[model samples]
Target: MKKILVIEDEEFVRENILELLDSEGLEVFGAENGRIGVDLAQQQQPDLILCDVMMPELDGYGVLTTLRQDSILATIPFIFLTAKAAKVDFRQGMELGADDYLTKPFTRAELLGAIASRLKKQEAVQEHYNTEIQQAKDRLSYLAHHDSLTELPNRLSLQELFKQVQPQDDNYQEVLAVLFVGLDRFSKINDNLGSDFGDSLLKAVAIRLKACVDDQDIVARINADQFTVILAKRNHKKDAADVAQSILTSISKIFVVAAQEVFITASIGLAFYRRDSIELQQLLSYAKKAMLQAKQQGGNQYQFYTATFHIISVDYLNLETSLRHALEREELVVYYQPQVDLKTGKISGAEALLRWHHPQRGIIKPDKFIPIAEETGLIIPIGEWVLQAACKQTKIWQDAGFHCLRVAVNLSGRQFSQIDLSQKILQILRETGFHPQHIDLELTESMLVSNTEVAIRRLKTLKSLGMQIAVDDFGTGYSSLSYLQEFPFDILKIDRCFVRNITANPHNAAITEAIIQIAKTLELKLIAEGVETEAELNFVCRHNCDLMQGYLFSEPVPPQEFEKLLFSGKNLQFSPKQDHEAKVR
Candidate 1:
């Protein structure tokens, strides 16, 4: 029911107004003064407010001012009741956001008519607001399950959809294959070309990719440049490969962008569904590794993941099983890499990279198993483990009177896609009794190239928690300077590819210097990665680089080794000469 409020100071006039409104069957609330009327307006949130201009303690103007202060009530209809007939009086009410003004001694019929009209308009405004709210909610829900750029089902939706394709019995175990297709250097398209045009091209490509599949087949956008295809009826490796080739052909056609025709190639990797242990994440990992193999083989091709693949071996399978049990078994460890200040050569921060030690196979590299964990939806648990481990270690260091340093953790692309990643980070800090300033999230360049809006939002949310965000491997992907400005990134790590050649060629040296200058101008901290030699170190120092990390100091070690290094208070020294003929180590 719509409620109406009547505001009039005069007792006789107030009673009369209420009586007239009551006779019309309106749900009426009343106040004798403007101040009380404003309070009533807020409490009742009426459809319309009939207010008298001349009243003690906050008049009609004051009531309107109060209403306008609240965004929720700013658009409520307001009708003024006043005896003052001056143009100035009318102008003052309207300028104060009043909806209507009626002269005193007006007939009840006239008052009723004006009230009805304003009430009808208010109803329409509310209806429109409701409709927009519903539409926005629907879009958000859809975006959660679908890629915003291509409108294709996202990885989450794919996982849910794949569960339905599972085999019910071993006798009739349904066999299928998933092909993971990734665009080679897709980030370059978005960075070199404008984002607007890049988005349009992706939409067009999605349309073509979707068109190539049948109703029974499932196609989803899983990564920035990656798409996944579920071949429900294909059980054999050759059948899956044929389908993969067909998709490559469909996507190979020239894409028209801004009237400029461009041809791009795709790399595809295939993993048989049932053959890959019947786990959605495990299958995705195999497919991605195979896709990487295709990319490594010069792209524009497909590779079917098989037992011959090094990552799908018995050792790898055991490692995956061990990783799933690591958290429960309490077998995860964190190793810290020091961030050295170029000017003072002192440690400023440490990046906490995760490591796992298997009882039988010894220490396992993150590159080998982290993708499996992420694909298997084990990242959330693993990420939480990293956060808690890092925070607890930091707190222990603080208690030991070690230098106060920020510990950074690499955030996978899947981690950033979660709506609660930032909140979870903050919650971990609070629960662990750690300071927000002691942690940061390191994300790759591809994370930003996808949905920048979502990436920016997550960045801002993390920044608000007093945690920092860094772009890791800065130069390897599509590095956009404009994104550097728009998004809140506190650090930029120059890719090892660029840093490797800094000491040899004059052109690479100049490019490295330019990048340093750009980072300096943007007031972003710069870190040179893969610094293995003194010459590279000196070159980075000469350019006023903020930090350096590579074999020159030490390789990524175990937690005990890292702790020993930190406690030794030792400064690493190296020979300052390099062979001109020597290439990067």
Candidate 2:
């Protein structure tokens, strides 16, 4: 039975309405005043409330306002019983949240009709609310199982699918291959290009990846730049290899995103389900290991999971974990390698090299963990720390009477591409009270070549700050000497590869000399790296290399040791001095 509340000041009228509602099969409640009506409404939480206009303690408008303010009783339909039916009186009740109204002497049929109509509409409003709630839940569920960007199955969904694919019978196992495809230098694209462009590219890559597999193959985006494929009924190793190669080719093709053509490559790693393990996580893990191995061996190829890959991957993962904590633990220290002017044999500047002093592992060279840092995007923060530390230390050295001491810090690809990079470096220099003119920022040719316009803009921004910019690792990338005229580079550092055997190897000597000659012709400063022998030193000095840093002069030493060298006035003694009266610094 429906419940109704009757709040009439007159006892006779209240009893009459209560009895009448009872006869109509409604379980009824009665109150003498508006105050009692509000109390009864909250206790009963009734479907509707009937209140009178005139009452001693509280009026009908007051009762309605109280009920409407309550979360529990707010939705109940409320009717005002008022003798006055003027427009102003009706407006007052309605404005106070009165749902419907009844005249002083209302008919039974009219009262019942109003109650029934409101109850029906309330049911409809509740139904609509429930539907909206269900839709929100459905959207959340879809997001949990799918990558929001590509709308591809996510890692969790892939694991669930793995469970369904696993057969119950111990002996009967389907021949399956789990492959993980990783995009090479995907981080570079994300760091250089905007995320919107990178997201568009990933979505395009997803479509191409799906096209590379059959209907039976399940594809998922398990990570930011990693896609996984589960091949069913393909047991042979060669079948998986062929699919991997196809995927590689498809990824390597030019991608047109946002009206721009982008070229990227992929490396794949696959593990046979039965050959590796029946477990899904194990298989995926094995595939990922091989994927890392392929990336370490220089990307754009496929590799099968080998026992050796697991060892290497574990080492990388552990080292990456340690590196993440190394900053907070104060294990990372900046080591300065003295870069000496070949002609004067006096220390010109020092290149700031990062070293990890792990408590358990002793001194860890950068090569062991720098790639891990680069791949994980840890280079940005670590690179910033190095800048701050280098600038502060160089400032200290200058204060100690070494006024001309210059400090050079390398910029990671991610750091170089950041839009606020110049501002950040400028802020650090200001905080450290270091002169921007005394600091040199070194970046690779590959970083500049990625987006020449952006590189030029950023370079000019840094240049405006009075800091020198050098293109490090010069000949290792695809950039030609024309890059010298294209970008605003103040110095070109010869890569260690060519400088290592410049005297012995004819090809290396030719390349090194050509770089030096072009840089000399362009009138840019030159620095030769990896000069470990007297012959290598003589060879670069013969070509008028302005500065050189290697084991021959000094290996990268701790700041304390470098400070000692500075205090002791250690200098390289070399002959065949070249006059630089015509050269501008």
Q: All candidates' TM-scores?
A: 0.53, 0.53
- lDDT tens digits by residue: candidate 1, 337-361: 8766665455566788888877777
Query: Candidate 2, which segments miss by more than 4 Å at Cα?
Result: 23-27, 311-585
lDDT of candidate model 1 versus the reference: 0.78
Model 1 alpha-carbon drift over 4 Å, by segment:
138-151, 163-174, 183-208, 234-238, 248-267, 294-303, 312-585
Query: Which run of 10 residues does model 2 get worst, by summed lDDT?
Result: 576-585
Residues 129-220 of candidate 2 have per-residue lDDT tens digits of 66754553344355447775688988767887877776677676456789999999999999999877998999999999999999877899
**Model 2, global lDDT:** 0.84
> What TM-score number comes out for model 2?
0.53
Q: Give the distance in Å from residue 462's predicted Cα in candidate 1 to where it truly belongs.
A: 13
